[model samples]
Target: MDPVTCAGLRFAYGASPVVCEVDLTVRESEMFALLGTNGAGKTTVMELVLGHRRPSGGTVRLFGRDPFRDRRRLASEVGVVLQDSGCALDLTVAETIRLWLRLYRRGEVARAAAGLLADVDLEHRAALRVRQLSGGERRRLDLAVALCGRPRLLLLDEPTSGLDPQARERTWDLLRDRRREGTTIVFTTHYLEEAEQTADRIAIMDRGRVALTGPVDLAASFRRIIEERIG
Candidate 1:
């Protein structure tokens, strides 16, 4: 089954439509990228996928289950790296990861969290407090937490935001490794170059609807609309 499906998805806030009649599907183990400017509702769509917000119209199915009604089942299969790292500053890195791991059932908490930190190149910083971590390190920690549950579907919002070129490249490599291991990844990023290099398919959104979607080749079509910039 497809990892995610959005059929005729529609959302509104106080009678103002943010998204209208949007349709999307993501096959498992594929790299799917959602592209849009701020306020285009990319994050809104993700929230719906995560069951944080229910759709006002249409239907959303995750792994063939209704996200709202089968929330626990849905949560077990999906992991997320939100834009914000909500961990307390006083918490040590290991402590923060351990806390997140304990929320899952039958997981190798200590071993998995340690492996995840290594996977994201954060092993060296594992002893630091959340406050002592650099912004990039914090983001990596969030990614590690998302991986602890061994989810089939991973959702990342601006996964490489605020990182230097080297760190961003490292992140791209890590995501590719995960993809090879059969994990479906849906990511939202304004980083065109990163998407061009990392995504198997791209969906460009404007005004809360997909403007175009296809393989990386679609970038050529988008060039006329967007200026060329790497960051």
Candidate 2:
């Protein structure tokens, strides 16, 4: 089964609609990217897929099950790193990871914590309080914590938004490694270059619906759209 599926999905806040009749499917082990300008409803779609928001209409499925209805059963299989993950600012980086491990799994908590820290290149910052970390560092921490349970599907929203080029590449490499290990990833980004380089498939959203969806080779079309939007 595909890791993600959305059919006729709809959402809104109050009377205004944000997403309308969107249909999408993400294949297993593929790196998929959702691209759009701010307020284009990409974030809404992310929330729907992660079961954080109920769809106003239609269905969202992860592995053939409604994500919201079967969240607990699906929790271990999915991980998410949002732009703001609501992480505790008071805890040390190491403490935060340990805490997540305590909440999510049973054994090898320490070992897993170590591995996650290494994966995000934050081993040296382990003792720093989360509040002390920079935005990029905190982003890395978010990724580390999201990976605590070793999920098969990873979801990210504007993950590289504020990262420097070096940090951005590192994040990409980490994701590439995970993809090599057969993990499916779905992410949203404004950085067209990054998406063009990393994504196997791309979906461009406009006015709350998918305007275009295709393989990465659609770069020429992508450039034209971006130019049109700019001009």
Candidate 3:
């Protein structure tokens, strides 16, 4: 089954329609990128897929089950990194990882904590409290927390938003490793170049709908599509 499937998905905040008739499918083990301008509904679509919001119309299924209804049962199989970490500010980095491992019911907290910290290059900051870390460090900690369960699918919104160039490259490398290990990743980003380089398929959103979707090669025509659909 596909990791994510949405058919005619729709959502609105009262009378303001945010997601309108979005149809998207993310294949298992594929790295799919959602590209769009601000307020184009990319993040809302992610929320719907993650079961954080119920769509007003159409269906959203993850692995053949309704995501919103089955979210608790499916939590073990999915990892997520969103814009806000929401981690306890007073918790040390290692403590935060340990908490996630415990919540996920993962054993060997010490080993797992070390490994997760290493995965995001956060081992050096293990003793620092969440509030003491810089923005990028906090983001890496969020990534570490997201990876606690060895998930089959990862949903990331602007996964590399605050990192330096080197850090961003490392993050992508880590994601590539996850993909090699059969993890499906679906992410939204404003970074077109990141999409072009890392995504196997790309969907460009405009005005709460997908304006174009094709292989990464479609990036060559991206500017034209944006102009045509968004202008």
Candidate 4:
């Protein structure tokens, strides 16, 4: 079975539907990207996958078990980096990572977080307070924390938000390295370039439904888009 699978997944807040029936599959050691505009229900889909939101219909499975019902087991395997996450403002970066280590008796969480920060070139700021970090730096810190759990499945919701071009490239490289180490990655992003760079496959959503889903190779798709633009 794929590491993650969803079939006919639907969600709504009250009577208002946010995500329409969606089907997706994610495999181990592969990077999958979800792309869409603002309010396109990308976050809702992710929440359902993470078990933070219950599906109104259909099924979501992580390693062939129901995601919402097996959340505790899923937690041991899933590492997450969300777009907006809270960090104690007074905590230094190292301290923050160590505290996260305490949450799981994961012996190497601190070392892992530090290694990830170093890999992302944030090692120099390791002692800085959360409130003192720049927007990009804070985003990197979030990713570092996500890695602390040493997860098999990494779910990143807009992982590169606020990063500069160079930082974004570096983050892409880091993800590539992680995938090489056999981690399954599922992430959301609006940037086509980021998707093409980091994803093995792309699922594009529009108006609460998937508009396109395929391998990320832009060779033909970009040509079609550019030809239309030129015409």
lDDT leader:
3
On a 0 to 100 scale, what is the lDDT of residue 110 in model 4?
A: 58
Query: What TM-score would you give candidate 1 relative to the actual structure?
Result: 0.93
Candidate 4 C-alpha lDDT tens digits along 62-138: 99888788898888788888768677989998888878776756777656767767976888998999999999999
Candidate 2 Cα deviation (angstroms), residue 199: 0.1
Compute each candidate's TM-score over C-alphas.
0.93, 0.96, 0.97, 0.91
Residue 21, model 3, lDDT = 95
Cα RMSD (Å) per model? Answer: 2.1, 1.3, 1.4, 2.7
Residue pairs that clash (backbone atoms under 3 angstroms), model 1? none
- Cα lDDT of model 1 by residue, 1-231, tens digit: 999999999889878988877899999899999887888788888888787788999999989998888988777688898888877899988888888788876377778778878888887888889999999889888888888777899999888888889988988888888889999999999866677788988887778787777887777566665443211
TM-score quality measure for candidate 2: 0.96
Cα deviation in Å at residue 202, candidate 2? 0.6
Query: Which residue pairs in candidate 2 collide?
Result: none
The sequence of per-residue lDDT tens digits that candidate 3 reaches over residues 71-189 is 99899999999868889999999999999999999999999999989989999999999999999888888888889988999999888989999999999999999999999999999
> Candidate 4's C-alpha lDDT?
0.84
Q: Whole-model lDDT, candidate 3?
A: 0.91
Q: Whole-model Cα lDDT per candidate?
A: 0.83, 0.89, 0.91, 0.84
Report the poorest 10 consecutive residues by lDDT, candidate 4: 222-231
